[model samples]
Target: MILKTKKPVVLLFALLLSLVLVGCNKTAYINSNNISEPSELKEALTQQNTVIIDARSAEEYAKGHLKGSINLTAGELTINEPVKAMLAPQEQINKVLSSKGISNDSNIFIYDNSGGVYSSRVWWTLKLYGHENVKVINNGVNAILDNDFELSLDIPSIKETNYEAKEVNSSYIATIDDVKKAIDDEDTTIIDVRSRAEFDEGAIPTAILYPHTKNLYSDGAFKSTRDTYLNYNDLGLKKDQSIILYCKSSFRATQTALLLEEAGYTNVKIYDGAWLEWSTKDMPKADKKPSTPATSQDAS
Candidate 1:
């Protein structure tokens, strides 16, 4: 009985299987592509190769956050005092990344307690520094809780890591001058993604309102699309329109832009400068009050 041992083949197969398993355990880099779901996130974090960032206030984070999440409040990035101190310069960001044991290649997911406010800001900031593996938690805290993931109160020990900033990508952001040019260009439609009050008070000279919030349900998530096309049609927005969106800051505008893109809009841009920059700049704004109707006696 000559039984040739297939031991070498079996060993090669075992090695390949091990390599596949190891690759699967590595952190998944997210971008516009590979946007992970809550379940996927749970699995990814379990592998211990990801950095979950809570883009909410430290207090809010303390109340509840995804397990093993690090805090870098979005408010801090926007010049708020305490949080800002934690993120004043690139050195601060590097320090935070190091403390969290995050490296330049870490898969980062940023979420906020509020809807999309701070999370989107963090998304924009990470992109500003040319970090491509970062993503915003689509529904923020709601997504995590709804997904039945556990939370923790333990603070993670900081581990220093090196982070390098690259030149900002001009395409991901719209400057005041870019907005001015877009307004003057007839082909572009500036959409005010703020509330009705914000629009009524005074908005970009000829911007139209297309509020970001909608009442719809998708597994407890806010419906990204309006219930009816008539809502957007009433605002003179056509399917082919090139739209620019702005809010108090770029936060809401980016959310609206994302929703618009998801809703089948072809050309969309976010004016991050938004009202914060618009109101301060020497630019035309719609007057807050409507002109009074002429008296009957005064009418010719």
Candidate 2:
């Protein structure tokens, strides 16, 4: 008689071993080059090819903004598409960039008054759309103002150019199916970057609760590269581990995603639908917490 059970057991062992080896061969990486200091930016802005994008509200930009900077809000870069804040289509991004006089070769610098949150959003969107020559101002617009850079109400004349986006790389984004598969995949980690209060209300079951604020320092700047690497590494996530990030609408998730990718995490993807789409579906959610608010220092 053939021993059918023994063959099945051996195949399972072989499959598991292959996965283990793949994880072991992957290397961890950490870098801090994407962040730009104010002094360096001050000199760079004098060059004709350098472009500064102020990612603030129109009202705020009208009040005052960096001289020679183009005013573009994060809202201009998204679509409802049934899911609010989803990254807009490539053609739409092209129009927005072209209208702002942004070319693919421009040495672009982005910033916002609200820490790096809004600026990071723009930076991530550009990177997703294949513009690799971009940087997020460290600590955001405040850093520039603190350096005595004056804000101008005068709008510099913009000579629009044809700024066509390159073919998008779909690997940077995730879909509902990816999340479902990742939920059961040993190699993947699903992260929920919502506030603790929001997370406690309900989150993807098994998703790690890491609030977006955790990526920021007390003064609103992003954590150093080493600190950011340490924070995620503490979660037992290997550098090569597949990560799916989502927040209420994945906006905050983008901030975390940017930091992770900058630190050399190669497999990061954003769940564009985020909780908005996930909650409406029949998928599982986390157990509700106690009536008392989360007291953890990292909560929200």
Candidate 3:
């Protein structure tokens, strides 16, 4: 008869082994080469086949843009109340993709001037449309200049290709109806990832402000665990809750989505159309309550 062992050593060893196995299984698959340095992008540009999209305003693009890049302004999409309408229709998106010689197989790199607000939006949009080989160039134009990449003032001629547009994943996007339904359901949490002014002045009837920046220029290229904890904790968000994030036009929301996912929030979705799409129609907006507004500064 053996004496009673302390802490059940054998049992504890078995439990530790099980935890190790579980940790190995919980892998996060973030898109690669998506937020690379300008040097990496420059090398990719010189490759035989690569599509670079300049997601800056036309004015900024006209001033100066990367060589061999196509223009797709993120701000113009929001000028119209309903931003969805501004987004090229499926046929138009397909047409442009074809005109730019971009196919399902082409490796695409997208970037913008204001941090990654536009570039991330384009990245999420491409993913929504089932284009998996898409990446966002972090730090936007400044990163290119810092890396000493060449810029061109003249627009290059685009060669058209036959690109087919497949159905987009609705789960990744939320419509006005979906937001309303989530409010009515009471089981879901709707997060407004916009500035406090945007949220307090008037916002989706029941959404709480969870503002987040695109995290390219100041806060590095990707969201880390600490960033998630700070943002989520400040907003009083629960890790287990089913969260939906949205911003003026889904740019910042996409960044928040990535952060939430990194924070172990299993069910997270981005309302790509966001407030730009929600506020356009006669959708309900929360009454403005006088309160201290949160700043849109980069999370340190």
Candidate 4:
């Protein structure tokens, strides 16, 4: 009877060992196409292929950040030569990302404190550089900090790796001439993703006001995919037509582009220089009420 009991116990231990091995092999990652929540980020931290990006200034990141996260600010991906905050060189971006220990297969999670402004810029930069395994943390830094998860002051030791830049996808971006051409095209739709107050002051001729915040909820999280689709659908937008987005600058445009693209809108493009360049060039501009009060025209 003792011998029989020993045989069963040994078999049970072997079975449990196999189960543990299988669990260890399992990978945990958030869906790249979806906006990631704090709970999902918590699970992603347990996975080996994940990398959290603190999309804030170095000084801000030094104060506190999600554990195991690396700092990558929007300023790093932009240059101020010909225009302020335009995209940096692809090779430079590749080198910076490689030095940060980001591999091609790494699942990047980006977050920032200023709403989704900074985080969305990084997200667009990565996507433009051909990184598809990326997601902006929903509701930005507030969502993460509110969860009461531990913040780390320690900077992680990164193991640098080679990261090659892929072929450029220019279709994702639009130029002033592109906007001019779209102005004449009936099949194209120009969207101004700024506040109604700003739109009332002055806007691109024929551009419709569809503020980027319309894509989010009161809590600051992105709405459901179905709801996002319906929201844009109410604007009479068909996925087949060319959709152009712009704001005072291009950050908000990038945010709206991401939301619409995820909602299945194809042929989407962003006028990178946006109203700043448009207004500077003496292009056709209009206001809802021409006699409205003057407001700040700074491009921030």
Candidate 5:
């Protein structure tokens, strides 16, 4: 009789190898070059056809912002989809970008006041929509002013461009079900990208604590690629393993996921609902401080 068991075992091994390769090939849309320094940006402005975007509230932008920069907040890029803060419809995104004179051919640079936090959100949105060239200025508006550059109160007249929307890249974002599967997958690594206090209070089971600030400098600039790699490498993360990132509401997770992806990680995904949906879904949550106060950090 034929040995049926041996053939089945060989098939299983082949399947596992194929899955690993797929994970390895899941590279992020952006890379390390997406991070720009103030001085370098100043020089680039002279040569490159660039569109600088200030990702802050309108009120904040009115106070003062970089000259020639357009104001585009996180709210404009998203809508109330199945979950709050989900990316907006393609038409909306295209309208916003085109109105701001942003085009697929332009080198887009984004920055925010609160560290690189809000800027990273805009970066994620653009990449999700398949805008090819985008970067977040290291530090932020302060980085520009600190270099003795000029700031303007006047809003520049925007000559709109035809910013088309490409196919949405769904691989960068993860769902609650995907997270549940990751929890059970031995090769998956779940990272908690919140503050130390927030992580100490409660987190997903088996998730590692890696604060988003750890990847940023006091000046708000992202650390060098070598430094960024070392920080995550300390956690014994492999370059090819699948990683799921989550924070209070998913903002910090997107920021942290970008850093990890820039540092050469092959597979990185953000849980858009993050802790908000995870806790509500009756999923496994571990609280290191079970007696902590009920009023914790805001999800946003």
Candidate 6:
């Protein structure tokens, strides 16, 4: 999502009306093969090495969750040391996954109560650490329940493993310096995926205001690849150009970044420090200050 050059404009805009009628289905996602239908989990839960992770609060996990799914909240995978809700270190990630009984070969499926905002962050975290076997459950817990899949109140016991995270996948991340360079880079686009109200309050200069909510359909499921590509391409983002995304932290950014890649955008990166770090620095900004300080709800 780029300025190097442009390609033939996608002609799928007219198909939106027909797509809206089919609702959410596995066939809808052609760009990324990382989505799982709720019904697919019925058999997935029975397979060895299959681990379903519920990326919600402990309280939410206690009330109900997909059967055999383990609970791993955002707090478990992130830190607030350098910035608000930055992703945890590789060592911490290894410990957390091992303690949760997630092995290197585990076929992991992650979900939240109903949306990708939280769960997708976890999915990106796994990918950053080289856990490519993971998939995010579309529509999450609500859809799984609606599909008549079983939920359990019983907390499963864990058999911890000796987990090791791979070398940091730098492609998914962008440092503050990288962002500074991109600010004036002719070929790069930095998107601020925060709310319109937040964007009005303050934002990095030149950052486009494309909220994370736009990534979902009215039903909270992700839009199809064609829809996502078409709608996002309206920003004149090229599939081959560079795109940088950020939100309050990078939770919301990861949500869009992953989808952008899924929609055939090859060069998407998340500014993990996001507005939190940028606001802290003496960098050039569009306004005086940000409106709201981040809350735990906004952090990933």
Best by TM-score: 6
Candidate 6 residue-wise lDDT, 1-300, digit = tens? 354333323335435644655454333543246877765666678889899999989999999887788999877889998898998999999999999999999998889964687888998999999989888887787677778877789999999998899987999899999999998998998889899888887798778777888777767777667777776777778999899999989888888876787788999999999899999998888855333332221111
lDDT of 2 at 171: 93
Per-candidate alpha-carbon RMSD to the true structure: 18.3, 13.6, 10.1, 16.0, 14.5, 9.2
Give one clash count per candidate, in the order shown. 5, 0, 0, 0, 1, 1
Candidates sorted on TM-score, descending: 6, 2, 5, 4, 3, 1
Give the lowest summed-lDDT range of ten residues in model 5.
291-300
- TM-scores, all candidates, are 0.71, 0.84, 0.73, 0.81, 0.81, 0.86
- Where is model 6 poorest over a 10-residue stretch in terms of lDDT? 291-300
Instruction: Name the TM-score of candidate 2.
Output: 0.84
> Given candidate 2, what's the lDDT at residue 86?
82
Q: Global lDDT of each model?
A: 0.63, 0.80, 0.67, 0.79, 0.78, 0.81
User: lDDT tens string, model 2, 147-210?
Assistant: 8997789999998999988887789889999999988898899998888789888888678888
Kindly report which residue pairs in candidate 2 clash with one another.
none
Ranking 4 against 6 by lDDT, winner: 6
Worst 10 residues of 1 by lDDT: 291-300
258, model 6: CA deviation in Å?
Answer: 1.8
